[model samples]
Target: MIKDMQDLRKLAYNRQLVSNNRLVLPEQVSALESYRVLEKPIYELIIDDLKTTSWTVDELSRRYGIAKEDIREPLLIAMRDPVLVAEGFVPRRVGRAQRNGKGSNVQYTLLPIPIEARIFDITLGLSLLHFDTLLVQHVDQLQFIPHDEGLDAFREIVAEYWSIRGDKVDQFISKQDVNCVLSALGPLFIPNDGGIYDRIRNKLFEEEKLLVPRFTRKKINKDIKKIRRKFSEGFFDLTDVHSTVIALSDLTRFCKYSNRMSEHAELLKISEDFFYSLFIQVHETVPVPASDADALTNDISEVSIGAGQSGTRDKEGTTAMSWEAPKCPVDGTIAEFYTVITSETAKITEKQNALRCLRKHLHAPGVFDLAICSLTTSANTNIQKEAIKLLAQLGDERAVEPLINVYGRVGATLSVEVIHALGSIGSHEAVPFLLEVLDQKRFENRIAAIKALGQIRDPRAVPVLIRCLLEPKGEIQRCATIALGDIGDTVAGPALIKLLHNPRSVIRVEAIRALVKLKYTEAIPVLQQLLGGDRSKAVRDEAVRSLKSLSMV
Candidate 1:
């Protein structure tokens, strides 16, 4: 009776209403083939079952004696196939009541195939299913795959998936499933695919209340302990090591952002242990070979000769001891020290001693480079913090870019260290980025940015710091006062003077000290007034100190 696509769709819809599962006619099968429905035997079986009644994957698996995993792919394919969708095979989730104390299951039912603009949705859904399946199948072996290609493909799929599903992606792919995929992909080292993780995080944030509560602290702690045990036992897959670390990092970050860090103290400690173990396993440096050392010595001798230094050659054709080339800054002892610092078998005391030696020679030729590399590559927080401190002390503009990069990639605690380093380096290049950090809503980040900005003493930050002085938070205003003083800018003088009249003695005391640093002679009268009339002894003492400093100037 079908004359056209409309007639076929109508027939298909009408057929679903009847109880009897009549045989499909040859003409009907041929008509369905035009829509590409029966391309595979699984497709045929799925379609035949749908013709009788909507079924869950579990039901289809049981009826055909197939594994649930085997049934899921074909079911997803049918739901997303363009031709099948156009022929009206729309998938809808139907909830079944709980049975035998088991939770309800989501079942897929088909709608009359639409002949409209569902093609894009169909393509996007299929693409998601395809990549999801691929990643799941090759999760452990992803290190062998081309990271850029896989990352690009997955990113594109996520973009399209987000465009269609928006915040409701959780409905299509559960939060647990998303977490599983992220755990697999987030820790990758070579591809550096944080963009994919960021996108998923943004989508999840749209329904954060619904999703975040499900990630229980107990469950996360259990997962971390299991991964850590495998990692320490040397049974963990090499490919999975980074994955485990990154997954823990993500969980730690999640708890921090959700204000649940207090509830996950054990999880954080375990995560730090995992990071330290990963660092010890992977960050070992090979010493220069003997041949390379000889070559380096020869190169140094040649450079000395070029610079008009006399280099005598012995009978063995080596440089004579009477006129030797200058020694390398990183000598054998320093090199050995570096080796011990990164050694997996080294005792804690041995490692600490090696670290001290390296710190003492931090100004040596290779030490700065080593610290920079460690800052970027080491997941251990203490090492990373030490590197940040050393790089800041070096005050080299070269460290600016690397410090900024680390700020973006690390967690809140490490980010503060990076900001401090940037400020201590005092490079104008960090100004723009530091200004951006000042705009963030995170209280800790904002405070760190303020302090860093002051240390850099960039006048460009004066206006922003002035605005922060007006905020209601006493901690913010206090920090801003110290920064303005460190910056020693006269423009903040009026704001600083106004704070002298505030009720909080701490605010008045900070303002008095800031005025003195600014050398604002005009504040000398206000300082004199405070010295005589301030109620708090601390404020009066600061005022007296400010007056004496101003009078000297």
Candidate 2:
């Protein structure tokens, strides 16, 4: 509900929680402005709900008027970018594929897209779009497991979509579309197996495999009949029967739990049978590879294992077999380091090494926890700097006090990064250091500090910021002014108004901006004075622009 920039800034400075001020980071702000095409619309659609809860693929798809499949690709890409997620943007998966042995289908969760990555996605939209094209073009490269004539079904779809004669599957479909078909077809072959469904889904997306069931003719016919019934009822909405079969073949997932009623079972069976017929029809219509004889060989080698064989060992000390462990060919330590850094799926030893490396690299004290306390003293300058940088990445508040204590130990780069990191950490302890930095004479350090405070959006910064606004330096005054605007405090309105008549055009302009950000109706008199009576036309123009922005807000 922050209605304007001033309110945003004030909340950032006054809030007990610390957070990054994206407005201060030119790169972030610039990126956000550029990426507006992609993020603005998506954000408007999901922002409200994302603040409080996660959205399922189906729900978001329904609400946004997009295919669930289409929604996931961007959602996944956004989630991988933390800056976007921090801004109250997020995506979530809907249903679980029934479990078998492998895993569940890939589902995307919704989250905020941070300013940094948002820029990249927007700037590189076209190039990334081509990646989908390439994926479809090279679909043949992916491997698939043969199930329920799954392999055949996959080939049929690929040939129909990508073969020399058939229609090209150029239109970008979403992961959700495929997911829907898989969910509906679950009852026929496998009742509730998420794992099996995932494997099948992967094969389909990757254009590798199918999920054909191994059963008697009668059973197969029954399942086919059920699937067909669903298809006729517009379950899949396919124009060509072959496309429907290809979809069903990929949709086949394992069912672990059964529906209590035979009627449900019968319905699933019919859906499957219907799908089988459609799949074959599509297969016949498509231009199959010239040599159909090789179909048998395709099936035979589908399950072949890669080279590199055996070892036997177990804690029992029997003839225990040792299987090959998955290892990266690069530095083993790097792998360990990543495991530690990710903190998602790694062992304790890897994490320790990661922490050790981070501690060694603590030159710029920031937020990522590169500092280590050896129980002696805290001013271990080098270690502390790296620790602060790492802490910024970690975004943990626990590092705040220690960071404030280490503030004076580093140079400009480290200080700037640390200030921002502290903002990101959103800790109240940082306010003191931020205030101290604002008191410093140098513009760079002072500006960084002011910007950090603004990002934190803590109201406590208002008085200190108000004091800075009284200073004469245009740079400091401008930073403080913008910080005030971003902070969005009406309390600073009077101080900001005082700047409107200052001799410096820059200060006058910034003051106008601050007032607009604060959205102080009382400032209409001051802005009008500046716009009509100011000596500089540029200053007057700037004031008018601020008025326009405020009006829009």
Candidate 3:
């Protein structure tokens, strides 16, 4: 890694003199001046040691005969500084098992600068030096062209300086080259764009081939069948799942564009099932949201296979397959429902109906396990929600950990469902995770977690709910009040009673109801006062009801 101003200057000088190319810009050099840590001997030593492989702070300290405390801060600063990252000096932080095998130590490993970033650096440098015309003229001759993030930046810079339209540049570049560059960039190139850039980037995404390259229609057809067979046999590798799905999608598009859809009827059926299977596998294995998975499946189908074209093609190319529900067993046993639910070929609605039917057999052998699988694996939000409701209805204590795991990994809507399930299950084991959710800043999640905590009726949540009652937001205070009542912890009685005088009558009403549920007769006198003198009729009505209950108790 280039560690100091001198090294950077030497690099730029050599590139300009020997290669006749300016690879580093003057601004980049100036930016390095602000990061004085680069000039430190320790920083240089650390970079050198990390160049060949990764090393822990302890290992580095031992190698350099310096105190660990002395080098840790500078090392950390270098690891995180954006200037270093942009300039390609920063090392990646990785973890390795400790000598004792207890945990892992953070190890710093130097990585070569990504080719895309390098391309950007070189293109920017050349453009700054008034070589834009030469760069544009010889673009095809350059061994490495920009792609992905660098491609966008390179296009922008070339367009701005060279005055060449981006579309014109695209004509000069082959699709195969673009696919090669994109594949080399890997899935790590996450796009964050807005305005015109967003539109352009999205158009590019739609037009460019995925990591999977195009093959002859014959080869594509063969590969699709092979992939489908592998999926059916449960022998498909999860690591290649994304590429395989994209390849199938590309094949579908090829069939459409080549007017070979009639010849590839089996491809359409296999593609539909394959997409659904991949959706389930993606949800189960990754933390992707249900909506995103839905979009992925929909986008592929709409762009490649065309929507509502899953059946046999008529002479006019309309679907000929009639919609029908899967046949249920005559006995309607739990095994039958499980079979329908777990079947890859079953429609989403059919599987969801199966899950709903399993509600009657909530405690049946293997039912809880099936629900857990659906909760974690089903890509359809409705099905996942149904499974969550079933799990909650089952009230199996063993369901707590799985629910908590799903809660942590899923999107907000499903997370709310998981919270409700945890509360309904009423397992003390879920209390800590629920309490953690309460501490989060998301209003919807916090509110859902609060209500769930109330349903759980865990005493440990009482103090936290009481604290939540003090929050300035009326919705939180109201939910906390109702939750305190559900918990029926006498310890929360005083806090609930205090809300009687709150400015918002809704809070006062909730407090009255909570007090009545807690049977806190001590609030009877206050309730009597509110019943007669409160300004709001709702508060007074609730106060009277509370008083009657408390008095009877």
Per-model TM against the reference: 0.41, 0.34, 0.41
* Candidate 3 ranges beyond 4 A from true positions: 1-332
* lDDT of candidates 1 onward, in order: 0.55, 0.45, 0.57
Best by lDDT: 3
TM-score of 1: 0.41
Choose 2 or 3, whichever is better by TM-score: 3
Candidate topping TM-score: 3
Candidate numbers sorted by TM-score from highest down: 3, 1, 2
**Residue 267, model 3: Cα distance from true site in angstroms:** 41
Residue range with the least summed lDDT across 10 consecutive positions in model 2: 179-188
Off by more than 4 A, model 2 = 1-335, 338-387, 411-413, 440-443, 549-553
Cα lDDT tens digits, model 1, 1-553, are 3365544443333222111223233245433443322222455678767655668877876676556776787687775444443343434444453544666544566544221112122221112112333344444533232333233323334344234332343233322222211221121112223334344233212232323543676876776676555443332122233234434444555566688756456555664444333222222232334443332223221212222124456564643211122333446647776665556676433442344456567566766665665565556554566677778788888777666645643444456778788888889888888777776655556777788888889899999999998998776898899999999989999999999988777899999989988999999887877654564557877888888888999
Cα lDDT for residue 395, candidate 2: 63
Q: Clash totals for all models, in order?
A: 4, 102, 0
| Candidate with more favorable, higher lDDT: 1 or 2 | 1
